[model samples]
Each structure stands twice: as C-alpha cells, then as structure tokens.
Target: MNLLSFWIAHRADMLGAIAQHLTLTLVATIAAIAIAVPLGIVATRRPRLGTALLTFANIAQTVPSLAMFGFLVALPLLGGVGARSALLVLILYALLPIMRNTVAGIQGIDRAARDAGVALGMTPQQLLLQVELPLAMPTMVAGVRVAAVVGVGAATIAAAIGAGGLGDYIFRGLSMTEPTLILAGAVPAALLALAVDASLGWLERAMTPGAARSRRVTTRAMTVGGVVLLLIVMGGYAVSGRWGSRVIVGSKNFSEQVILGELLAQVIERTTDLSVERRLNLGGTFISDQALQSGAIDAYVEYTGTALTAIFHQPVLRDHVDVLERVTAAYAATGRAVLSPLGFNNTFAILIRAADAQRLNLTTISDAAPHTPGWKAAFGYEFLEREDGYKGLVRTYGLRFAGTPHVMDLTLSYRALAGGSVDLIAGEATSGLIKGLDLYMLEDDRRYFPPYHAIPVVRTETLAAHPELRTAIERLAGRISEEAMRQMNYDVDVSRRDVTVVAREFLDTVLQSP
Candidate 1:
C-alpha cells in the first residue's frame, strides 16, 4: 500500500499511538519540571547540594536507555512492563538538562539586580518570587524544551516494554521488514518532536523580559490551568477501555510472536465475551514472562525449548516430552501453567545466504565450520545470552570465526545476513524469511539444540477467574501446523499482509469442525 493508504487503514492505531506518545512525553516533562525547578531554586542557595544533585543527574545520564529499562524492570514497586517504569526512566533522563539550566539561569543573573531587590526593602522570599524567577524563566524554559524533545525520542524505547507509543510501529516494521510500517511510526515521531520543540521554544521566547506576548495567556493562573488540562488528558487516556471484561494478551518482540499473539487474542474474542487487549511486542522472553507472572498480562505464547533453557536455566534435553514436562512443572511452581503445544518445533536454525550455501556446497554446520574463520557473524540479543545459543553452538561445532558475533535484533538479523552485512545468524526453524530472503539453514548434524514446540503460557489464577479462557485456549491445541505458521509469518514478513487479516483467516480454519 502507498503511505497515504497505510495511514488511512491504520489511522485508529496511529492516532492511539500519537496520543500515547504525547501523554508519555508531556507527563514525564511535567514531572521533571516540578522536581527540578525546586531543586534548581534551592541549589542557588546551597552549592554543596547543587554539586551532589548535578553529580547524581550526570550519572543517570550515563546509563544506556535500554539497559536502564532492563535494570528497572527487575526492581520492586517502581518497576514493571508499563508506563510506571518507563516514566521513571524518562524522568531520570530529563533531570540533568532542566536542573542545570535552572542553576545557570539563576547564577548568571547580575549581582546588582539582587542587591537592588534587597535595597528596595523586599524580603529574601519576595526577592526570589518577584525578581529572580522572572529573570530566569526564559532560561529555565529552554531547559524544559530540551527535556521534552529528548523525552519524545526516548519514549520510543518504552514501547519495548508494552508502554504504547510510536515505537510500536517502528519495532513492528523492523520485525516484518516493511519500510512503510516503520515510516508510519517514525515520521509521526519526528513531527511530534518538532511540534514539541516549537511549542516550548515559543514559550521560552515569550517568557523573555522584552519579548511581546499576551499577558493574559502567560499569567500564573493560565499556566496552572494548562498543566491541569494536560493532567486531565493523561488521566482520561490511562483509564479509558482499560477496565471491564478484558484479557491483556502480550507477546515478545518478533513477527512470529505477534502473529501468535493475534491468534490467541482472536480465539479468546471468538469463544468468550471477554474483550482482548493486545499488549504485543513486549520485549523478549524474560519480559513477557515477568509480565505474565506478575499478572500484568493474562497470557502469551512461549516455546518448550525456550522455557527450559532460557527461563528454567536447565540443561538442554533432546527428548521433547521431557523438555515440555520439566518446563510445565517449573512454570507451575511459579503460579503459571503451560498449555498444549501448538504443533510446531521452531528450534534455532543456523542461517547463511542461500547463494553462498550453494557456491560453497555447505549442507551442514560442520561443512561451514572450516570456512568460518574469516567470517563475521551477527546474532540476536537473546541468542547471544540464551543457554542454547551462540556460545553453546560454537562450542559444540568447535567453530571459530574471525571475531565475536555482533549482537543484533532478531528480526533485523535475517536481513543483515541476506544483505551480506553478516555471514551468519541464528534464525527460527519456521521463519518465513528463510525462504523469502533466500537464506539456508545449515543442518544441525550433532543435534546440539533442543526441541522448541510453541505453547501458550498463562497465569493459573487467571484461568480460575475466567474459566472460558481455558476453553478458548484449548481450541487451538495442536491446531497450527508448522507450515500454516510459516505461511502466516510469510504473509506478514514477506507478503506484507497485516497481522490481523492473517490471524483472522488462520483462526477461522482452526475453529472449523472436522
């Protein structure tokens, strides 16, 4: 579809994302202003406190956005996969600029201006309120403008943890290898950032001592009213459609997981009265698991092999039954249950370009091992760290490459290999990109990897609360064959079909009687 047509079709989604993006940015910026402005004011008095506050803010600025998120998600109360944790991260990132500008704006004021206020019989509090703040307003606002713009960009990362925003579109497009989808998210985000910068820039200029502006609109009451209006918008967005009979279905950040997530949501909607709230694209295995266990998400699909090795941290087993059983028991111990397998074993496939495979006559992992000494490899973040991933595979094959594999997003790794950016990637066994991108999966001659049968993992308590959820979930047991899954993936990844259309068509087949 053309860009305009895509926007027309997905307008609701786009608008929703824009609202979420605005809410996240506005809320975080406001909160930062409230905290930093006071701190800035006090810093003008106590130089020691100012030094400490600046030092702490500078340290926070040094932490990587994604790394900070991962660290925060593991903490209690203030952490989780939502706006709660995302807000904290954004707030920390915004603190440095706002506070620094506050200090600079106040400290940069002339000594004569302060002495004049004191000589005019004004108290310290009155001098600050009447003279100091008015003079510093423009500079302080410049700091806020910086913070809001930065927050707009950083808020995209929040989507990885299910905090809805434009980043969802960016991540979705990347996973499916669809440029149009990426632009749908990215273009709006860029525009939003510009819009925010301009709005605040105007405010900054207006607050200047000599700048001409409407006195009524710039009054304290007007400013307070504007803040209240923003808070109201944020509150309205947060609580709307969030309650009622709903099951929040979540998925990991990949095309297949999204398709599977849609499949589960569709089935639940078809079989029950419950409304399905899709929180898909919640980053990686552990994040989804944390969401499910914490009751933040009712359910999501997982794999037996991933469950055993990645979650359980146990030894990889060849027997599918043993793997599934151990995974099931382990999940039960954590108040979750593993549902019936979805009739696919999407194990790790060592992929290389098909043309290279044919030219080198590489048919198995061992065949390519001797040629790997000069090749650079790329791997997904999870694959590099998972028990059944890069290190283990290298150890098992006794293969040595030119250097350590570069970590990459799982979806992008497919295109990277096809584009010759990297010689190798660990792809899914049932990934449509294997065929679509002309990539070949080398035979795992030694059977180093375990079976990765897809299954729905859910909170046991949720099942008790909503008994029909079990019925809806069970209807999909052993229904989706590997080929069917591959086609659904191909429809999304290669054919550029929307996930809902693909999921609804597939779910129809599953619901049909024998």
Candidate 2:
C-alpha cells in the first residue's frame, strides 16, 4: 500500500500516535524551559557556574537517547516502564539546547540596558524581570523552539522503549519491509515538527518590542492552526475507539517477533472468538513490552536474555533452562506471565563470512577477536554500545584488531558479512538465512553469551481473566524447533511471504489438528 492509503486505512492509529508524540515532546520541552530559564539567569550572574552547567548538559547530549531511556527504565525512583522512562530520556535530550540558549540569551542582552535599570532604582531582581528577560525573550524562545523540534525527533526513538509515537508506523514499516508504512509515520512526524517550529517562531516574534501588531495576529493564527490540528488528532482517536471493531495487535520489529505475535493473534481470534487486528513490526523488545503495558498492544514475543539484561538488569547466563526459569519468575512478580518457550534458543551468535572463517581458521568469538583488531567488525546499533555487547566481549577476551568498527542494524550486518564488507558480526541468530548466505556460527566454547529462548509473554491480568489463553499460546511454544523457526524466518525474510498467512497456517497445523 502507498503512504496515503496506509494513512487512510490506519488513520486512527496514526492520530493516536501523533497525540502521544506531541504530548511527550511538549511536556519535556515545557519542563526543560522552566528548569533551564532559572538556571540560565543564575549562570548570567556567575559565569563559572554557567560553564559547569553547560558542561553537564553537553555531556548528557552525548549519551544516546535510547541508552538514556534504558538507563532510566532501570532506575527505581524515576523509572517504571512505558512513557515515564521515555519522557525522562526526552527531557534529558532537550536540556542542552534549552539550557545553553537560556544562558546565551541572558548574557547576550545589551549590558547598557541593565545599567539603565539599575540607575532607575531597580533591584537586581527587578532589573532581570523588567529589562534582561524581556530583551532576551526572543533568543530564549528560539532555544525553546529548537529544543521542541529536537524533542519531537528524539521522541520517535521513544517508540523503541514503548512510548507510542509516529515512530510506531516507521518501525513497523521497517520490520515488515513496507515503505508505505514507514511514510505513514515519517510524514506526520516531519509535519508535526514543522508545525511546532512555526508556531513557536510566531510566539517569539510576537513577544518582541516594536514588532508589528499584524505579525502578532499572524502568529496567533498559526498557533490556532496547530491547536486545531492537535484537536483533530485527539478526536480521531476517540472516534476510532468508539467505532473500530478491530483489536490492534503489535510486535517488535524483527522476523521472530512478527511471526510470534501474528501467530498469537491468529490463535486468539480463532480459538477465543475475538476479533483481531494486527499492528506488527513495532521496533525493539523494550518498545514492544512498553506498548503492551500502555495498552497500545495486547502482547508481543520477547526473549529471556532481553528480559534479564535489558529489562531486569540481571547478569547474563549460559544455561538455557536456568535463564528461562529466572526470567519467567522475575517477570511473573510484575504481574506478567511467560507462556511456554518455543523450545528454540536464538541466542546471540557471532558469524563470519565462510571465506574469512576458512582463511583464519577462526572457531569462536575469542579467536575472531584477535583478527578483529586488523579487520573491520560490524555490529547492530545496540550491540555496539551495550555494556554486555561487543565491546565488553572484546575487552573480556583481550583481543585486538587493526580496523575501525562500524554499527548497523542486525539485518544489515548479515548482508555486510555476506558481501565481504565486515570481518565479523557480533550478534546473529541461528537461522537459515545466515546459513543460506554461506556463513557459519563460531562455537562459543566458553559460553559467554546468555541463553535467549523464544517465549510468549502476556500480562497476568489477561491470563487471570482467560486461563484458556495460556494453553492456546503454550501449544505453539516449544513446538517450534530450531529448524521450524529457521524455515518460518526464511519464508518471511528471504522468500517474501506474508507473515500473517504463514502464522495462520502454522496455527492451524498446530492447534486445529488432532
């Protein structure tokens, strides 16, 4: 489907996503401005303090927004999963621009104006409120405007953490390889950014002294337009909830996640008589989990490794059964239940081009690490920075190579390895596609990586109300062997078959037959 048709068909979701995106960006920007403005005023008086504050803000800006989200999600006080964590990360991202601008605006004000205020019997506070602030308003507002746009853009990544936004469509599109779905998200997000930037610009200009009243009126009109657009988005979501009969399901953006979510939705509809609507391809594991918690989705597939490391902050494990049991127990305490595992472990496996492996006689991650120093190593975005990711492993093994490393998505890493562009890829799953590409997984003789079993996870509340749901889902769990997962992934990722169709067939074969 084209972008226009996809928007029309899924307008309600698009609208809801936009609402979420705006709400997150606005709240973060407003908070950032409130905090930064005061700090900016303080810094204007104490230039040294301003330097210290700016340094911290700049450092914060270097931290990846997603990594910040993950760090916040693990914190006990400010983190609780879903939009809360996403919001915290957005706020952090907004701080530098807003804070820096506030300081700059205050310091940039004509010094003579402040002297005039003091001569006119004004106190420091009075001078700041009457002279410096008003004169500096335009610059400060510009900073806020920049922060707002950056917040909105960064908030799209929040979708990866379960903060629903226009990014949902884009990530879903990416997973499903549907360009139209991607545009459904990208177009609205870009438009929203523009709309917000324009409105803020007008507000800034309107506040300036000697600015024409006609310009102020035009600015007012732009603000009104933005408000109306926001209202329309909210109204669309309300209408969708009232009239839409579909149960919108979603999945993380990956082959296995899409397959499992599609399978579960199909089973739920066929076996429980519930209407089903699929919204698969929703980004990463944390994003999928957050979506379910926020009621953006009913459920999605997750792995024991992700739950333990990314979600729970536990140490990695090598024993499959032990990891599964620990993860199931931990998640259960949070009122979430893990349906039986799919008997297959898709743990992170390091893979090399057949030619490279043969040339170097590399047989494990450690062995590959030495050659990696001299050869380019490619990894997924997360794997490159994660503490337990490639860098950690490389350090642990004390291996050095000669080439610079690059990071890309997991799928892209596979292609790069096959095309002889990368010497090694750190995290690959045991699937047919890698095999088909003439690559081989090196044995981790030391078993450094954690066990990652495919499993169906559902909210405990859902299972409590419908006990039979567990059985229906578990029937498919552990039933899908390694070979089966490989074939299914091949069908969707390599052969280009529809995921829903493949899921339906698999469900019928497993659940319907005697």
Candidate 3:
C-alpha cells in the first residue's frame, strides 16, 4: 500500500503506537533527568564520587537492551513485564547521555565565571543557580536531546514486553518480510525523532543568551513543541487500553506464533463471550512463559519440544505422544495446561537459499555438512542454546561453519537468508518462508532434531475462572494439518494477508464444520 493509504487504513493503531512511543520516551527522559541531574551535580562537585557514579551508569549502558529487559522481568516488584519494566530499562539506557552531558556541561564552565559570581557576594547556591546553570543550559539540553532520541529507538524494543509501540509493526513486518509494514513503523518513528530533536534544538537555541532569533520563531517552536509533548502525555493514558474481564493472548515475535496467537484468540472470541486482548510480538520463550505464570497473559500457542526442553529442562524423546504427555504432566503442577497438539510438527530444519542448494547439490543436512566449514550459518537465540538446535546438529553431522554462527531473532534469520547475508539458517520446517522465499530445507537424515508438535497452552486458573474457555479452545485441537499451517503462514507472510483475516477465516471454515 502507498504511505497515505497505509496510514489511513491503520490510523488508529498507528496513533496509539506513536502515542505510546512518545509517552515511553518522555516519561523515561523526565525520570532520568530528575535522577541524573542531581547525580551529575554531585559528581561535578565531588570528583571522587564521579568515578563510581559514571561507572555504574556505564555498566547499565553496557547491558544489551533485550538482556536488560529480560533481567528486569525477573526482579521482584520493581521489575515485571509491561510498560513498568520497559520504562525502567529505557531510563537506565537514557541515563548515561543525560548524566555525562550534565557533568561535562558544568565542568566545562569557565573558572572565571564562578569566581566573578563569588566576588559579587553570591552564595554558593546562588552562583550555581544563576551563573553556572544558565551557562550550562545549552550543553545539558544537548544531553536531553541525545537521551530523547535514544529513548525513541529503545521504546521500540518495549513492544517485546507487551508495552505497545511502533516496534510492533517493524517486528511484524520483519517476520513477514514486508518492507512497507516495516516502513510504516520506521517512517513515523524517524519523523517523531526528528520532530523531537528539532524542537529540543529550538529550545536549546532559545536558552542561549546571545542566540539570535525572532519572537515569532520562538513562539512557533514553543507552541508546536508543547502540543507534541502534551499529545504524548495524554495519548499514553489513552493508548494503554484497559483489559478488564478479557483473555490476554500473547505470542513470540515471529510470523508463525503471531498467526497462531490470532488463531487462538479468534477461537476464544468466537466461541465465548469474553473479549480477547492480543499481546503479540512479545519477546522469546522466557518472556511469554513468565507472563503466563504471572497471569499477565491467559494463553498462547507453544511447541511441545520447546516446552519439554527449554521450559521443563528435559531430555529429548523420540516418541511424540510421550513427549506431549510428559510436558502436560509437568505443566499440571504449575497450574498450566498443555492442550492437545494442533496436528503439526513444526520441527527445526536447516535451510539454504534454493539456488544455493541446487548449485551445491545439497539435499540433506549430511550433504551440506561437508561444505559448512566454508559457509556462514545464522541461527536464532533459542536455536543457538537449545540441545536440538545448532550444538547437537553440528555435533551429529561433524560440521562447523567458517566462523561463529550469527545469532539473532528467529524471524530475522529468514530475512538474513533471503538477503544472501547468511549461507544457511536454522528455520522451522513449516515456515511459509521456506516456499515463499524459494529456500530448501536440508533433510535431517541423522535425526538429531526432536519433534516439535504445535499446541495451545493455557493457564489452568483462567480455565477455571471461565470454564467455557476450555470447551471453546479445545475445538481447535488436531485441526490444522502441517500442509494447512504452511499455507496459512504463506498466505500471511508471502501474500501479505492480515493475520486476523487468515485466522478468522480458518476458524469459520474448519472449526464450524460438522
């Protein structure tokens, strides 16, 4: 779709996303400024404390955004899922810029200025407030500008925590390989950042004593800037829609999971009276599992293999029924239910671009194994760590890449492979991208990988609270065949169909049949 048409179609959602993005940035910036300014001042005054304080902020900056978000999720009270954790991480990410700038701004002031203020009989406080602060305003504002922009980008990651923002579109687009959708999120974010930076620049200029500008220009800047800031603050309150008496369904940040989440959500919504709150594009397994445990989400689609190995920490079993039964029994103790398998095993498969596969005459993992030493392979974070993933596969085949495999989000692996940036990737056997992108999955002739039958997992407590939900959801069991799922995925990922449409259509046709 054209930019205007896209915006028109998703105007409300975009408005809400932009609002949440702005609010996240604004709140984090304000909080960081409040804490950082004092810390910066104290550090400036006492040089010894500066080292420790700066070091602490540097350590926070060093933590990767995703890792930090995950770490914070485990923290008691202060850390959990949603906007709270997102804001806290963003504040931490934003502190260094503001704090460093604050210190530099104050330290850079001329010694003569302080001496002059003292000679004029100004108290220490008075000198700081009148002379130093005014002189340092420009530099400090620059720090705020940097922090604001940084926060904007970081806020996109907040979507992973159920803190909605433009990243939702960017991530969804990435998974579906839709550039227009990515741009829908990206263009607005860039514009928002530019708007913020320009407004802050105007404010910085206005703060400078000798900066020349017309009153009209200053007034215009102030008016536009104030409106934008106000919209952010107000929009945040509006965008965080309430979820009273609703079933929250979450999904991992990938095309398949999102489609499955929509499937479950559509089933529940259609079969029962309860509303469905979609928390799609969330972070990986841990994030979703934690959200489920904490009752932040009611249900989500999960794979038996992922639950068996990653969540339960169990050894691989060849028997599909045994694996499902074992996982279900283990989850029962935790008050979660592993529903019936969704009639497909979306097992992990090693994939290469179709042309490359054809050229090398590689038809199986073993066939490709010999050439792996010269090829660069990319894998998802979970795939890199899971026993059934890269480690075992490489061991089983005695294959090693030219260098350490590139680890990234699962969805991005498809993009990387399609772009020819990576020679091979760990992909789902049933991913629509396999057919859509003209990629070929290398056969697991050695049987290193275990079964990964898709299933719907729900909180037992939610089932009890709304007993009808059980009946509503169970209707989908053993309905989606492997071929059917791949086509559904292809429809969404390749044809660029809306997930809700695909899901709802499936539910209407399949589940409603006699």
Worst 10 residues of 1 by lDDT: 234-243
CA lDDT, every model vs. true structure: 0.88, 0.75, 0.86
For each candidate in turn, give its C-alpha RMSD to the true structure in angstroms: 2.7, 5.9, 3.8
lDDT of 1 by residue, 480-506 (tens): 888888888888998999898999999
Rate residue 506 of model 1 by lDDT: 90
Local lDDT at 140 for model 3: 92
Model 3 lDDT per residue over 281-343, tens place? 887888888888877788998898999989989998778889989999988999998887889
Q: What is the overall TM-score of model 3 with all chains considered together?
A: 0.85
Per-residue alpha-carbon lDDT of model 2 for 283-382, expressed as tens digits? 6665567656655565667878878888788887777788888998998887788888878888888888888788888777777765666777787766
**Model 1, residue pairs in steric clash:** none
TM-score between model 2 and native: 0.72
Stretches off by above 4 angstroms in model 2 are 45-48, 107-131, 169-184, 236-253, 265-300, 303-336, 343-408, 422-453, 459-462, 465-484, 495-514
lDDT of 2 at 194: 96
Which of 1 and 3 is ahead in TM-score?
1
Clashes in model 2: which pairs?
Answer: 342-478, 343-478, 372-401, 373-400, 373-401, 373-402, 374-401, 374-402
Q: Model 1, which residues run further than 4 Å from truth?
A: 210-213, 217-240, 243-245, 359-361
Global Cα lDDT for candidate 3: 0.86
Q: What RMSD does model 2 have?
A: 5.9
